[model samples]
Target chain A: MAIATDARPQRTTTVPRRKRVRRTKGQKAFAVFNYAMFAIFALICAYPFYYLIINSVSANNLSALGDVRFWPIGFHLSNYGQVFQLQGLTLATAVSVARTVLGTAGTVLVSAFLGFMFTQERMWGRAFWYRFTVITMYFSAGLIPVFLIIKGLGLTNNFWVYVIPYLVQPFNIILVKTFVESMPRSLQEAAEIDGANILQVFFRVYLPNMTPILATVAIFSAVAQWNMFQDTLIYITDQSLYTLQYLLYMFINQANSLATAAQNAAGGSLSSIASAATSQTSTSIQMTVAVVVVLPIIFIYPLFQRFFVKGIMLGAVKG
Target chain B: MTTQAVLQEAASSNLVREQENTLKRGSRKRVGGKPNGKKSIGMFLCILPFLVLIFVFSYLPLYGWIFSLYDYQPALGLQGSAFVGFQWFEMLVSSPTQMAQILQVLANTLAMSFLGIATSILPLIFAVFLNEVKAPWFRNIVQTLTTLPNFISWVLVYMIAFSLFSSSGLVNSVLTDSGIITTPVKFLDSGDHVWITMLLWSLWKGLGWGAIIYLAAITGIDPALYESARIDGAGRFQLMRFITIPQLMPTYVVLLMLSVANLLNNGMDQYYVFQNAFNMQHIQVLDLYVYNVGLTGNNLSLATAIGMLKSLISVILLLTVNLIAKRARGTSII
Candidate 1:
């Protein structure tokens, strides 16, 4: 829907060119200025990632001295290799990937199912249950109380803490429901008329048609699950359960001790891989971990950006 | 949030009408015969697990609110602890020190939220100008880059901040080497302009993403409005001033109200990651205060009380905003 509308304006713009108003110098200048400003702003937004990436790959002392500005100096993957060498780094990365996959899968599946189910009037107490679930969006149980509930449920140190509690996300359901409603109902009816039950109709007809909205939900869930650090901060005390993002959080905040401990864990052998002038320092390690944490989002968001624009438009209109 | 979209959808009678239309169309065509009891039950069974999960995570957690009524010793457990029945609430106002601390935190939260609300127009302006850009490719690249930061975690944001502003960081080195200052400026660590700094960081992250909704609103405006205005010889600026801003005003107003309703919920993650001893006094907002008091300070009951109040007050504000929106715009925000 959003892409179609976006395309309309582009189509409209071309028609104005055939008219008698030849391109004026003032308009040309304004366009140039606007394009330049946007380019500068884009650079500002992107430079930090470039800066971090360059510094992470740069010689350690040069990076720490801040001499690697604008570009990498004595570039190498030693920091990245050493970042993985930090004790618990592998475990945290595994935990982060596992939770992101499981959490996003659970959220998308349930949201899609609930979204489809809500449209089925045959479900018992459909409206009541729909509102009951959606109303949770309006309020929260508060941080401490929710923490206690997680504790009481014995999920405080459990990996499922990352997945289960977030599975029934209300907004994704609404997005799917709205998207499904917007779709033509003929296919769904055909399936139903072919003697398919609600479950079969949902999976075969509605689910396939709902792909765009589901992709949007998947991106939201994945980014959230990947970036979430607070739940780990509060709920999980187990070392093995530390998420990669949380581990990065600790490394950044704790500054000296935890990172050097990681360095020590990397120990003399990994340090021996580099000369003294370019050995991986704490700052380089922090940057490397940050790059690691952000790379997935940087790659994933752009691919689904168009789909989410549609999702956001659906949400904005509904709002 | 993903949930905010759902919350908006919840109040939409559009879904109900659409479902009704589909149902009536179906029955009229005999596409689906009246679903048997078995089929209906099977449909219900499919969603039954989700209903249970919602109850457990959403409703069951409310039972933990009872801890606010007690001293809430984790070691002794809730049953063993003495019921304090609003004592924590009383202490929130009764003790001078606690009152001062709570006031400071509340002040920080409101200050940041107001700053946020104040700059809410940035996105609208951005979208307006962005729409003027005839180059679609440039627009997408700019949008993609600017929106990138919003998707990253705040901890990663802190990493960016640290890399740019730490004593040995790039910004400081650039400035000091150029003899702009004798000493490197303490950009991240300083307590001064903390609210403004936090607001700027948030804007840097959210401005482009926020503009997306307005951009959608902009697109929804009838192209005929622009065509007619162009035929009238209205300049680009004039068309924008007359048509674009006016069309976007309602969306801007509604979002502003929603932001106002969320005044107490300056989420803690950014504050948490940025906090240091130097900035602790100024940076502690309500949500951060709740986290610190509960987990770090180990005063779970007090934190629970504060959290409960924040939730209650936020819900009240939302309803109030909805009422005001209904009166002003003839539509409820909820």
Candidate 2:
């Protein structure tokens, strides 16, 4: 199982390669048209997000009329302030931070251990373990079955509800196994010769070498857990235990909450709160939520951005 | 450095092994006869957390699949629930409404997924071209901007769409200003456009992220291949066709395999986020349907039965594709 591919970066094979031949007049026109078309399409695909930021801070007129565009007419941080007051943005932020840390740590530990154990050459019943994990990968017991199981196990309404069910992601296991199996056998042999047992070799020699892959996996797992909304919706009936995404979900779905937001912002005008509540329900709020939720990942991504390309190429090429 | 030294080394190894046997017995006695006991204990301790979580969440919930056989009530727990042995599944098949909905959902899911795959091809082609552009700054900027959509949530994507396509949104304003149509098109409500919208948006969000793997594959390809092709008077198109595409084929095959395997996964988050009652009929994929039935409708048992059926079909489809690849192309996913 410990097939080490790490040392051998596949040597490049030479092939009959393509050349960038000069375009004929007609072909050049076609190329220009293609570039124009794709550029327009990319801009169209990206404009809404640009529009979102512009709309979020524009005057109420622009947002209510959906007229927000390339720039804001005037800056008004009212919406952001409203969201903060309505939800106590800091509380939700704290909850998200806590959940991300706890959940990512839990997932990395479980998936890494399972991956390590699964890749062990001398471990008995290797086929059974592989089949077992892979079966779940292909054939899940469905969401309801999972829900019922959680309920059956009395995991519902607990913070562990978020942390437990997804503790061992099968794909991450595969990724970790790919990395683990690629470790050089000489490390293990050297450790064994030094009187280190299997556990000692895995922990002391193997685990330390896996830091880069583990960090990358942790980033993926953390983003997933931090953005987990639907699970909290299902497993957590109590408001107190809801994750950040669920809170955003509530803001988006619940009109009263929006009204409450307006009321809380205005400090006593029930009618203005009521009037602005439904009318001000622009797409901007949704974008605001998207911006906030994704901001952490965007900021964090650059640190490990290089690893993603490496990880995917490795996983795909090896497979 | 000599043969006698090697012989002496071998002799010492044998002598050390003999002494080690006595030490092993003494150590076993020291640790109550459990040879390798410390290692095993450490191994168990290392694996303990994972075992507890998986058992409670994965293996333990497996028993709840029994609800597919029972007219289950959550309040009653497993014991008090009525066991009806495939009755739920039988009902799923026998009822035309249920069966038709499931089939339609499957078809819609497949169509949307196919549309997504189709949309991705153009992006792949575009990315390759983008790579060929001489300006490094422009290429890097485009690449960075393209992945922006990947970071955004489904909910936000839908909002962006809603503003663009809604009755009073920008598109309607343009159509009215141009005097092309008398009234707003009700784009979100238009059944004809719902599937297209879903496919388009999914592609938009996924295009850059999707192209990333292909780009890596293309880049990792040996440039010498292209150089030789140039020497042979091959045109750009010919080079891409023969060299680049062939080089990228393995990545493409694996990507296609994954796309095929998860064909039914028409992203509930995106669909649900974008859905309105008006468009639900057109956009309701199997995942959304299951969510509505099981959780929203509170027919927990029925949802499980439906989920079970879908999972079975998906597994079958995945295996079939894998087997076909194995037999014909020798590039199985497994």
Best by DockQ: 1
User: How far does residue A214 in candidate 1 sit from its true spot (Å)?
Assistant: 1.3
Candidate 2: the clashing residue pairs are A17-B225, A17-B226, A18-B239
Q: Where does the lowest 10-residue lDDT sum fall in candidate 2 chain A? A: A1-10
Q: Which TM-score value belongs to model 2?
A: 0.82
Candidate 1 structure quality by residue, lDDT tens digits, B196-300: 889888888888787787777787887878777776878778888998888878777777777888889888999999999889889999999999999999999
**What 10-residue stretch in candidate 1 chain B is worst by lDDT?**
B1-10
Docking quality tier of candidate 2? Answer: acceptable
Q: TM-score of A-chain in each prediction?
A: 0.89, 0.81
Quote the lDDT for B21 in model 1: 58
Q: What would the per-residue lDDT of candidate 1 be over residues A1-319, giving only the tens digit for each residue?
A: 2233241233355455535566689988988988888888889899999999998888888888677887888878877777787888999999999999999999999999898888776667766888898878788879998888889889999999999999998878877876776776677778877998777888887887777778878887888899999999999889999999899888877777865675576667655675854565778888999999999888877888886676677657434
lDDT score, candidate 1, position A79:
75
Colliding residue pairs in candidate 1: none
The segments of candidate 1 whose C-alpha lies over 4 angstroms from its true place after superposition are A1-29, A184-189, A266-273, B1-39
